[model samples]
Target: MTFRQKNKITVLGHDIKAGENCELSFGVANLHTSSSVDVPVIIERSKKPGPVVLFTAGIHGDEVNGVEIIRQIIAKGINKPKAGTIICIPIINVFGFINLNREFPDGRDLNRVFPGTKNGSLASRVAYKLVNEVIPDVDFIMDFHTGGAGRFNAPQIRIAKNNPKLDKLADVFGSPFVLYSKNIKKSFRNTCHKLDIPILLFEGGKSFHIDDQVTNTAVNGAKRVLNHLGMLSTRFKISKPKKMPVYILDSRWQRASFSGMFKPSIAINSKVTKGDVIGNITDPYGKFNHFVKASNSGYIINVNESPIVYQGDALFHITTKLK
Candidate 1:
């Protein structure tokens, strides 16, 4: 297959070529009197054609792990895909990322605004454009993500639908855990699936920080997915990921119950038994303390990092049983 130079497609003011890979900044808007915003996309093309895979991150903005993972992959270089193209969008919500926030300037969760309207809110327009222009060009997508700020998550792949093909892809990701979930109402992955595009969501570590272990797992898992798709050669193989017992947990927020300083006993991935004291929430006066207990036996998949808490603030996210 010979590579030819195709004409350029301009997004906002940046150029993306059809045959060759390029980076382009799309859309421009003002949130305030002085500043404007633009989304960055890196499109890489193989000399030979193959399945085009889109690697996107920062949809929730504060999820730094996914952003970094995408950055590292492009910087390192991907092997030639056997058929199409590869599009990598490291940070889709620049406004939220800059503020270290999970939502947009309007306080809307960008992840929920999928297949958005062209003339709607800033987030909606971005989603609409992404679904219309970018995603339609890909055969598959692998979206990267992490827990929001003040929360932690185990490195895992989320299979939202029951496609055996996708399940096999998730297994090939080689993570210690794979979360079987159904498509959430309006998530980007769900929207893509509606378009007959198979998209896998890879969640690892926590928001706003980078963990080398989690990053490595994400990269290796994505590489395996590419290999499984025949986008890349299968010369490099990874051991089957350890199977952690799968749980369809009825997860709920364990709030502080009162405004106080939280002293947490468990960290992410800590196993706890039912009735175990997970943390202590104390008032300013050394006088009163309330114990935070586990209602069920499970591993602490997410824990609050901040000590200062308000009533109704989420403290822990547990996934019961380990495989």
Candidate 2:
């Protein structure tokens, strides 16, 4: 794979200077329609060398807020890193990003296909490219995401519980809450951790739409990481790192029993008690109303926002309640 070196104008130390950022091609593929596609990376290498931290978004493609956040960071003339490199892949699943869809054109979830195979499915091939050409080079990795279509997730961090370093990194972002997650099946975080590479998951916003608050929060967090890694000289007054954030070892999705308009009584991040009325499923024809209640007491980490739902569709994602 060949890479081209380009000098990009960066605002560092209150002045604009041209710096080298890498444009490396990951892998190429031929679409069934006879067109070719290439996955490339944008790496900002500082004049002084320090730890390399990779910040990626669009792992799910539909997660737009993170993508916007990355874009803003690269474009905004704010504090610049003094040492090491910052690789920003604002759009990972390019095909999905183009189509404004969550899954790849091959109908696979890119997040669940990690450390992929050289010769495998589309998702696997891309995952392999990331793990080999990208992951191995970074000292730390931050993957950004947002709630999928039909759901809303508050700005939060998700870190693997075993890595104290990664856990500390999560709190530096100053989000309202953090979740201690385990190695999910075939997840990118799982693959990165297996290689002892610390990774943090920051999820916010909603798919196909940009939320200003989430974007700002993510931009601030990325800058803080740059500061934390010594890539930048400016001091970010990160709020004191929070105690190990509450953990949700397990979560379950509550699905709708019947299709109708969903009037949610609870908001994302709200705490609910067992049997609390969370929402009401009602008919637009004004004949039927079904109440939805919490089966267990916990934090409402996620809620459906699609307004309408189908039978058996997931409606709520409840994290274990904090005592």
Candidate 3:
């Protein structure tokens, strides 16, 4: 195994040997004044050669749930994968993270630009660096994400369809909800697929505050994958969820019929039937009031936490079971 024997590796101008782990500051951007901001990526390699896996978070910056998930894994230091290399970038979009926003300083969505161009915008440059240099070398990827714009995801795994390998990987993570997404033109997932590297996306909670349920679920999911891959020992028997994951075939957002002070009747992940009152929209000063009902039956996957909404705004992201 390549990792089993001593080997030298250099990244960001830092040298790392097999069976070791270290943090390297990767240069991303520089301001006109003088200094540049470099992001930190932690690399861990095993003595035995195996698969190379990567975990990334903070693509949206305010989506700190994913960022925290990676941090906990690194802080615990329990996962010294016995076979392969694990590289983690707990915070990838330093600009978005520091600003508590979803996009780059230039207001471009980082996730929308992939296989980035160094000569392009800041988001483009960062994406280009990872796609050209970091992503091609990995065998597997587990990208973490969370809801944005006050939207909350019901702890789920979003994957690509028609790929058994991706399906199996998603199953291993074993979230309550498994969403199959068609490729978006410039998204990271699309770019990775083009490179033939399988990537699994785990999304839960909302941006900013860390939700305990979603955070813990994501951490365990990654460990489960390592155990399955023979990197982490499966001995001692890890507990499984009482129920299996629900596969979602289709989903839609329940938009507001009119603008008002929103009052939700249900919580995230709640089961509802067609015509169920998802919420009520009422005006504080006037007698105008309206109820939002489900168009079809299934689970309430994502909902906006913000009560103030306008007409035609998406108020609820509802999911339907696969036939």
Candidate 4:
């Protein structure tokens, strides 16, 4: 967890100097079949002195879109940076990514266990390493993520509510939706905010899958941010939204009133008024039917997309925001 010295940065026995780029192998805890889980860090340090920004993904392991976005950045685009360093961690939660799960082996969310202790659980240790070693050394950061399985998120940016500066960064990233989010306790974004390091959380697509449009949004967004920070040159084309972004105040899940075959009447971004029917839950044999209604007037941000549902299951996620 220690670095050799500044200028000649040593991370997990890999030495990186100015203008040097390489894949640094960070050894995580040893497994039965392998000596250690080698977390590859793609480090690129420019000759000119400037800021250091980190692009991180796969914190939940199942979120592959962010991982692919980071991979695309590191593969070729990052070399275009004019000054400063860019560190890309395509997959942070190695165990979760390997198992295609969200939580660590100890049944804890890695993102929710920031600034962890060395003697703590696996998730804690990983969080500790990131908080202590990675984030502190970076000037800015971009954390990419996606919706859970069966749910899709419109390309959006989530920032701490009331933070105007961060909101501007979200604008630079150019997502059509900007969520003024309440910081989750001990989350990666929360930790960064506490440290006063500028960070952006980009959410889009769905877990374990990739969309070409969403991927481009993410890549161009990163390019925009880097360009803003004076690390990368311009000529990067960012996608523009025809409709203005919706500023969300809050969101809540709409639970199914009946256990039955569910069919959604609303799609993502569909506008609805209060008491509007969003979907229908009916018996398999078409005996009983219950129409799901919206509680607050807003756009349908998420649809369960599951054909079958049980009573009390969240079938729709709606927010009280309209643009």
Score every model by TM-score: 0.83, 0.84, 0.92, 0.89
Instruction: By TM-score, rank the candidates, best first.
Output: 3, 4, 2, 1
lDDT per residue for candidate 4 within 78-195, as digits (tens), equals 5356777788889999888888898887899998898788879888998888887666667788999999966778788888777777877777777767877878998999989998
Model 4 — which ten-residue stretch has the worst lDDT?
1-10
lDDT values of the candidates? 0.75, 0.75, 0.82, 0.79
Which structure among the candidates has the greatest TM-score? Answer: 3
Residues 1-323, model 2: lDDT tens digits: 11123233222112212356656655446667877666656666677656667788888878888888888877773334677667778888888887888988889998898888989989898888788766655677888999886688877888766666766777666676677667798999889888878788998878988988778777777776676666665554443433434555666788898999998888887878889999999999999999999988888888888888989988998875441
Between which residue pairs do clashes occur in model 1?
49-82, 49-83, 49-84, 50-82, 50-83, 50-84, 244-323, 245-322, 245-323
List candidate 1 stretches off by more than 4 Å. Answer: 1-19, 30-38, 79-84, 233-250, 320-323
Model 1 scores worst on lDDT over the 10 consecutive residues at: 1-10
Model 2: runs farther than 4 Å from truth?
1-19, 30-40, 77-79, 233-250
- lDDT by residue for model 1 over 1-323, one digit each (tens)? 12223344343344555457666776647668766666767776655556667899989888999999998777767533443567788888888888888899878888898878999988898888888777655677889999776676777778764587677777677776667777876789789878888878888888879999889888888777777666654445544555633533245456678889988898666778889999999988899899999977876767887879889888887765333
User: Which scores higher on TM-score, 1 or 4?
Assistant: 4
Question: Any runs in candidate 4 off by more than 4 Å, and if so which?
Answer: 1-15, 241-244, 321-323
Q: On TM-score, who's better, 2 or 3?
A: 3
Colliding residue pairs in candidate 4? none
